[model samples]
Target: MPQHLTIVTHPLVSHKLTIMRKKETSTAGFRKLLREISLLLAYEVTRELPLTTETIETPIETMEAPVIEGRKLALVSILRAGNGLLDGILELIPAARVGFIGLYRDPETLQPVEYYKKLPEHMEDRYTIVVDPMLATGNSSVAAIDMLKAAGAKNIRFLCLLASPEGVARMKAAHPDVPVVTAALDRGLDDHGYIVPGLGDAGDRMFGTR
Candidate 1:
């Protein structure tokens, strides 16, 4: 079984995350780094995927080769910032079915408001992964997972570039069955509900909106 929370500590992941966190990193640079780092995170998130062996004939002999079991897994991006991580993970798992849940946080309430949702079919038969860039207050992440569960996604995992203790704890309380995979778990959320020392507004940095 996968741990409830897995922080990817690989040197390459760490180095790329450091570059991404720099305030001076250009939008192009930040976007490029996010794609690179996300691939590394995807590696860790899928580490425990079940595998089954199949007999195959090699040039020299016949042997059993392990292959991922079950139907193609689903990648559900919690949109806007989630697309950054989604693109890279798709590069690593091209055949995985894709889905999207569009949610925006209400500035006044800091609550998630769902605007759109389109998920692949047979979610219950697939291992679903919900990707988002930052897990701040965890309200949005929790809401996104709730939508997935309602759509029949029983086996699910959450992936992000950065997380906060408050956010992680909220997820644990709301959905203990799903595991979390992230590049880093930062200090905590600020009064405004942003992760402290975080790479300032992932969507803005990636898209140069700010």
Candidate 2:
């Protein structure tokens, strides 16, 4: 398990998750639920952000107020499905800087190979958050982290819609310094390497296709 794995089964998250779990849920519905869950997940993900006091004027009187402390945050989407989770997270943290990393697995080796990547400036100074809908084999998530590290991202966090034990273990071994936050961690991976009870290819479900 990840050093920090908050499996959110909250009523809101669970309800939306069930709607998405149904195989008959329309592509649009799946996409929408992912967005809802992402928003809820954002609540859990940013729970520990430090706060600071600031001087501000209230409607009634001028007084000191509490506000988010430290530097602006960064969000990295592990494309292309990661983009699904990214959309909702962005809603909650609209001011957060965004980044992307696209990777594919080698046919024979089943290892990760980077295809595309673009990140925000001064990533080293930002608290980075990387997201993906599913963490099955953990290949892509690990590879995505490697890309961020290569670019000098220090304070990094991982977010996902669903995860498998294999993926969780892989992340712990590969990037223990980083924390993983997910909504659900299912039984395990399947034959072709997808989460066993997972909703299916998150990209396909969200986009409506094979």
Candidate 3:
């Protein structure tokens, strides 16, 4: 099992993230970079997945090959920004079972409120990975994982493009059993609960909305 938090330090991921943080980057460019970066982050998050060997016949001979051991993974997106990350990961693992959990932060309280949820069945049997673009306050991510556990998801992981120290700590305190994989951990959140020196509202940037 990976640690409570794993920051992906891959050079490609870092370079792309730098471009994403720029204020002048267009919506189209930001969306494109997010999809590309998610692919790299996906590679890191699934690194510790269990593996088993299986016999296979090659063109010339028969041999044993390593294969992922378990049910088709469940990828849950914490909408609506999570869709950006989910799209790229789905490209890499096309057969993965997909689901969605809709949660919006209450601006006044800075808390999460669930509006919708649709998860794959037999979550307990699957290696579930929850995708969200930012772990700014960690309120929504924690709430999402709480719902997943209630749905019987035991082997769960959280994947995000960026995180703040406060958010990471909050997640650690609330859900220590779930590991977190992120491209970068930026400075703490600002007064408005947004990460400082971080990419702006991910959903807005990705969808060309205010």
Across 82-177, the per-residue lDDT of candidate 3 in tens digits comes to: 999999999999999999999999999999999999999999999999999999999999999999999999999999999999999999999999
lDDT of 1 by residue, 13-76 (tens): 9999999999999999999999999898998888878899999999999999999999998999
Residues 1-210 of candidate 2: C-alpha lDDT, one tens digit per residue: 236667888999988887888899999888888998999999888877768999998889989888887778899998789889999989999999999898876767768788899999988888889999888899989989988999999888898989999999999899988888888889998778889798988888988878
Clashing pairs in 2: none
**Candidate 3: which stretches are off by over 4 Å?**
none
TM-score of 1: 0.97
TM-score of 3: 0.98
Candidate 2 CA-lDDT value: 0.87
lDDT of each candidate versus the true structure: 0.94, 0.87, 0.95
Going through the candidates in the order shown, the clash numbers are 0, 0, 0
The candidate that achieves the highest lDDT relative to the unseen native structure: 3
- Model 1, position 26, has a per-residue lDDT of 97
Question: Candidate 1 — what's its lDDT?
Answer: 0.94
RMSD, one per candidate, in order: 0.9, 1.7, 0.7
Worst 10 residues of 1 by lDDT: 41-50
Which model is ahead, 1 or 3, in terms of lDDT?
A: 3
